[model samples]
Target: MASSSISNAEANTNQPRETKFEKLTKRGRENQAKEVTKMEKTRWTSDAEQQNYSVKLVEALSQRSHGNSSPAAEVSHVAVRETADRLLAVAAKGRTRWSRSIVMSRLRLKLNPNKHKKQKKPKVAGDMRSKKPVAVAKKIPAVERKVRLLGRLVPGCRKLSFPNLLGEATDYIAALEMQVRAMTVLSGLLTGTESLAPQFDPLGSGRS
Candidate 1:
């Protein structure tokens, strides 16, 4: 009878310990689920966190076997792959949501007519006092005479007097002489026959 009672006490003591271990295991599983849910939430909000969780989860699975190669390792690898796939899906969903938000914002802006108009005054013929105005020709400035452009001359030579044409011919001759002098200066510089620092004249030396 005493042996039976001792056996019962041992069984009772072991039962509480086993129950505690079971509770601990259950709590661990619950905690793991909570952690996964939290990780999923973060992945939905942030790409960086999603990547980090994927890496961490894979690393945890890989380290579970402690450098031993076996069927257990293969199982761990499979688990890691599955978890990564799920997390990647979550990340993809998040990216899709972000894309939808951007598209919607663009559509809203496009649909707003008030945004297309601004402070620019509209052109109306009734708002103008006259359609055209005439002015007398003025003499070209000395600075303007030295500068030339292809499309700037008045059509039909109307701006030129005989004396102006003579002056233009003189200017053309002067330009030709200046070009010859510039070539001579460049050749002298190339042959190292000219002084390096007399006047700061780049066009004459043809450096450009």
Candidate 2:
């Protein structure tokens, strides 16, 4: 009997205790969902937190870009690609759809600097003042057509439905706002430094 009990205990030990996902009760499930949702909340929702994040983001950009590469590597000075990674980091909360779309698009551009090169402007298709509508253009609903144009503007949203694409656009706009704010703060700091002043003011204007 003692030997049988010992063997049974060993078998139980070998078996995984948490092998199955324990189904939560309805109330438990709701609580669990709330917890999960809270995990993805933006780190900068509060004013204090926003101020903190802005400071950290600028500090990070200064650390990453300072002395890491040659003057030529500052190609992103105009493109602002150097700030892309940090912007993406700030937007990463909740894995929002638009953030993902723009991040992927920008990442592709970052990996292929050639994509950033200015391309020859294509010839204008034709005059835009004509009041006579084309047959195919008349067939499409104005709302639908507008949505399609928005999809083109929001990267990775070509196939998304109108509602989803709007969500993406909203998020993308928010991310862009964050990027602008971050760049503004960083630029303010750099403006005071004499060494980098000329780069910002290539014309040699004393006041930036």
Candidate 3:
């Protein structure tokens, strides 16, 4: 029984212990994570440096603008040189150093920054004289305009032209004339009037 108990103790000792640390990913994944972290740090540094440079540039410009006008040209030259020096100092501390042309270009960009901005053309009343004459809209004839309006009102009138309208009016007048003649004859036949309906008897029975 003691030997069996000793074996059980040995078995407990031989079992693997649980680790406190988490398991790491593969080497490639670890390297990728490290690179991503490094890129983020670099991006943050670059953004901070850019913001610093922009602030310094604005301060320098404001100083130059507020300086004395008696020796304005000289003061501007001094400001440009000072700004260039500051930029060079910052660049030297960074990963990359700017070339002479690049430094000058940056200085010029800061000094003449308006050249990079989009310039809107000033609205001048005089520009109206230079503009091409706007073509006048053709005036629609009154009759044709009325006809088109009528066509919209009446679906059957859509195919009606000027000649068609005139012809339809003529036909309507003729139909009215025929109805009036028929009404007169019917009245004469009922009242036996000789003036409205002359006699038409055969063999000259009702003649004279």
TM-score, cand. 3: 0.22
Worst 10 residues of 2 by lDDT: 196-205
> In TM-score terms, which candidate is top?
2
Q: Tens-digit lDDT track for model 2 on 118-183?
A: 888656677665446688688999888888889888767879987778766776666566556545
lDDT against true structure, model 3: 0.51
Give residue 131's lDDT in candidate 3 (0 to 100): 68
Over 1-208, each residue of candidate 3 has an lDDT whose tens digit, in order, gives 9999999999999998655442334565788889965753453234234334444554565577777576554445566656645553344343221223345556678899877688788889767765656453136677877877655443233556766554434433333343344335434654777686533321123443
Give every collision pair in model 2. none
Q: Flag regions of model 1 displaced more than 4 Å.
A: 1-161, 195-198, 201-208
- TM-score (all chains, Cα) for each model: 0.19, 0.52, 0.22
lDDT of each: 0.46, 0.60, 0.51
Q: Evaluate residue 15 in candidate 3 and report its C-alpha lDDT on the 0 to 100 scale.
A: 93
